[model samples]
Target: MSKVVLITGASSGIGKSIAIFLTEKGYNVYGTSRNPKNIESFPFKLIALDVLKVDTINDAVNFIIKQEGKLDILINNAGMGITGPIEDTPTDEMRAVFNTNLFGAIDVMKAVLPQMRQQKSGVIVNVTSIAGYMGLPFRGLYSATKGALETITEATSMEVKPFGIKVVCVAPGDFATNIAAGRYHTPVFENSAYKENYQMNLDLMDAHVSEGMDPIEMAKAVHRIIETKNPKIHYKLGGFLEKFSIVLKRILPDRVYEKMLMNHYKL
Candidate 1:
């Protein structure tokens, strides 16, 4: 029997690409979006799901369980990005990002684990970002969400290993996708201190994301992660410079890393 896989935020971008790629490879794929109607002409089934809502998550999983008998893989890829300084970002706005990026991912993982535990085998992949490892200029909150998810993914792997469930984090650098269209640009105040630098950094960040790696590359990384029996706890998928930056951050001094970031972002 073909393995059953479920992915969240499947309306577009990396999530959508992964779903299509996996489906073409003969995995029984189910993708989720807040509105199933938005996913037009998808190869796999589009399940209505709002990751922030527990009931919708449960319903989506239950539907999959009923149809496939077991969920062999799950990609917690639903997330959003926001741009603003830490102080300039409103508490409610920060919560909204975390709601979908962190809490929502965890909630879905919770909903799916029982079955994986029962079956004694499953793969859970969380789509994080390169920003998770290093703080970005105006996208601090977005970085925080991904960073938190990465840590959670680590902890989850340790806890669930006995059940034969593998939890992995795939941190992709920028990719060519509609993510910028959905990105929340925090309101800039006329007299705000961070107005100039914030605007400059935000524009640069948007441009980088628009011209970054292909989404198919990320999809292929997910494919490899699922196919491998013993996948690593974390996988960084992106360009050479992007992946190199992670290594630099670990080896370089704090001040040097800070300077590199400031120069790159023109902060």
Candidate 2:
């Protein structure tokens, strides 16, 4: 039988691209949405699953196992974006993103591990962000969420290896998606200390997303990783500069890298 796959946040954007691509490749793909009823149709199976809700996560995982007998791959792609100066960003909102991006992803992995463990094999790919590797000016909350997930993936991969399971993190740079529409934007308050610079950085961020590479490229990258015999713990998919920035950070002095980012954002 073809590999059974589950992908979260598949109503649109990168998750949708990956689901469709994998379905076309003959994998038994099950994509998820917070409101599956809202989506009239999808190329593969689209189910209701809100990552913030552990019950929904468990139900979805159980439903898949019942239908497929076994799940071979899981693409933990559900996440949201938040942008604002760290001080201006609401504490509750920061916690909300963490719940969805980090805790929720972990919960899903927990739900699947038993079945995967019993089967003696499985692969979990967590979709992170290139922004996670650095503290971007107005996107500190978003960066932190993905960054935390990256670390979790590293630890989880080692823990599950003996179970014949694989865990990987695929961090993508800006991709032309409707993420901006869904992001929680802390309003640009006129009296706020970061008003001018924050607004400028927000505009710059939107422009970058609008001009970003195709989501299909991300799908292709995931496909390649899934097919590998021994995939690396972390993989980054982005433009040359975006990926290189991580490398530069490793080799450059602290102040030097900070200066480069400040110059890039004109802060």
Give a tens-digit lDDT track for model 2, residues 1-267.
Answer: 999999999999999999999999999999999999978798899998998888999999999999989999999999999999998988999999999999999999999999999999999999999999999889988999999999999999999999999999999999999999999999999999999999999899999999999999999999999999999999999999999999999999999999999999999
**Which residue pairs clash within candidate 2?**
none
* Residue 182's lDDT in candidate 1: 93
TM-score of each: 0.98, 0.99
Clash count (model 1, backbone only): 0
Model 2 spans with C-alpha error above 4 angstroms = none
> Pairs clashing in candidate 1?
none
Q: Which parts of model 1 have CA positions greater than 4 angstroms off?
A: none
Model 2 — TM-score against the truth? 0.99
